[model samples]
Target chain A: MTLDLDTARRLIAGTRSAAHERGLKPLTVVVLDAGGHVVAAEREDGSSAKRFEIAHGKAYGAVSMGLGSRALMDRAEQQPYFIAAVTSAVGGSLVPVPGGVLVRDGDGTLLGAVGVTGDTSDNDEAAAVAGIGAAGLTAQPAA
Target chain B: MTLDLDTARRLIAGTRSAAHERGLKPLTVVVLDAGGHVVAAEREDGSSAKRFEIAHGKAYGAVSMGLGSRALMDRAEQQPYFIAAVTSAVGGSLVPVPGGVLVRDGDGTLLGAVGVTGDTSDNDEAAAVAGIGAAGLTAQPAA
Candidate 1:
């Protein structure tokens, strides 16, 4: 239920390495705890104003759904009427897309999550996977 | 940095899972892209409206400064005037407090950031970290 600062640092470092390996463009990473609260956040220079919100939303959507944004998007597609109505009702923070997942210990203990932006969802997902492994945790694939 | 739909879901899924496991109250998680734009967002059904803005502002601040909210809060202490000015200048999307970190990659690429506010700073950071890992990225430490 708790996240350590040392672990968080490792998570970021791992993500950075993965991104560079792939030669992805500038990216932003975020960490959230199990309680669905903010843990750590960052933005890169030249990142647009909207980028901040977009990153947050992408990750938020993934965290909220307990699945990758792409999976959620697929679910939303199956129920367009409900999804559209929910989006309209919620206004902000409800994103239907891919590129996010859940972080769990080997025993399936919850350990919070990580989100990445500034690239394709596939790349973002790839980076997230890399970070989770660096942190010594497991990334549950989208269902 | 560009924020996409895939990463959005990852952030939310991790955050929510953390909350669900920890028995924290219902929460609203928000992720912001590098440009401060909303890439994805999600609020727990029982969460209040206040959570939405708090999450947005905190995440926005993290991305805006390329650091976590906790780090930003510390800096604000040294320059209260500047922090206050930013709050007033950019309303509803800049909570200068602890709990959020800047999103970054291994090579220090700027992607996007995330923010959460349903719990304390520590809890917030936890959720943020969970989100980051869920997305396969890393969150920077508060400097």
Candidate 2:
């Protein structure tokens, strides 16, 4: 399945709806193309604008590295220098957080990703995961 | 125009080059997915720790709204409530600042955006814009 703009948009809308239904706080939901590009992004009102972009970075970084942003965050915690160096090496394209996941189709085909932010990392992750579920997509665990 | 991870990375690298070439302080750069979600982000060494997130927000907000952060900032000045409403509308996905630009392709599609911080708003905007240009993508002005 291609993570085209239409699909990406649907994912984001679903994410937003879940957040709204759950009375979740403002959230930043980002959609990426299979190539790890932006397809659709939206931030619930009153959520941190930064979350919108940061979530994207985390998701994109995860997609690019095939790992979750939290893993990077963990690495950053233990090896600040290495993480910092890599951060420097990549010119700031990598951020570690739990706000990212790969978007997959029914058969596990890579569709793209939906990243969410604006709450605790766990909540953010839940929101994104829920959103993906809403869209009939699966979220790849950050391995 | 699509904003792929590769292009986003190149844009970020170029922004850093420009900053370093000018001996600017470490900065933060953020790349959002096409859905105005974050795809990649980095905080330069010596830059504010929060810069990473803030810059990401600025860019994410810009992409989500399909407008420049600066314009959003201006709107925030007089219509704080309106800006606030936007934040609520998208779950806090709107940030009005001067450091974000829309990422587009030659065909003018909304791919995503980049935001930078750790310098003056002008400087941040410059870096983000430069990053987009370096990636061979168009950074469109706010409509």
Candidate 3:
């Protein structure tokens, strides 16, 4: 199923609120649909310029691999060369970071993924999880 | 000003409608903020897999150069070696095509750009112009 625009917007808003509540640095949030295409994205004022590209790379990696970026990070650690090859093949859009989370519907159908950047990786992951939850979706890491 | 999600969605919808009216091939549309960050994008069913990337490249080239892709195409034709070098420097994310158009506000402030693919260059440019107009924005080519 496709990731609806409303949910994507809600995810962005939720992520922003989560970051604000924690007093984290400005963030860039990106949501990619099931086809690994951008649905919505936002870069908060004062965010580092690279945050948007980082967020997009994380989301692209998650959707393209059908796994959360954390899972990719773990796999990359063991297979560095493989990840490097894949990154180069995809024009360097894969980011094996902790902040990319896969979104699933109630039936466990893949909806998309949300990627957050501009803070610690752990904090970014936490905000992404909260945002997915706020959008009434489950955040599932790859098994 | 940045390209907001609402305006991006409207642009996509407008482009889709234009394509349908003209019986063009399925299209992929991408919008980038003034900072050259993707704001939103959509790839219609039946569009080629690379359409999204092509659309994004067109939009990125437009916003990054502060000119429509048609203008870039003209320049590239006159300065092929320089354009090639610049495209290589940017990692091949620049598409100097007619489909990329700059978005501007009423007072002529650049907001972002819209790129359309999956049709003839002229048709794609027409759809992009229609999309920008539908969003209540101006589509300005470089002087």
Per-residue alpha-carbon lDDT of candidate 3 for residues B6-119, written as tens digits (9 for 90 to 100): 787788889888889989987878888898876666667667656778998888888878889999999988998877887877765888888999999999999899988989
**lDDT per residue (tens digit) for residues A1-143 in model 1:** 24544465567668768888998876666665565444454444344555554655666666665666677678788987865676566555755655465678889876766767778877877887888898889885365
Interface RMSD of 1: 9.4
What lDDT tens digits, residue by residue, belong to model 3 across residues A45-143? 667656778998888889888989999999899998977888888765889979989999999999889999999998998999988888888996544
lDDT of 2 by residue, B33-83 (tens): 665556677787788667766887787788667798888988898899998
Point to the candidate with the largest TM-score.
Answer: 3
- Candidate 3, pairs of clashing residues: none
DockQ of each: 0.09, 0.04, 0.26
- TM-score of model number 1: 0.52
Best lDDT among the predictions, by candidate number: 3
CAPRI-style docking class of model 3 based on DockQ: acceptable
Error of 3 at B11 (Å): 4.7
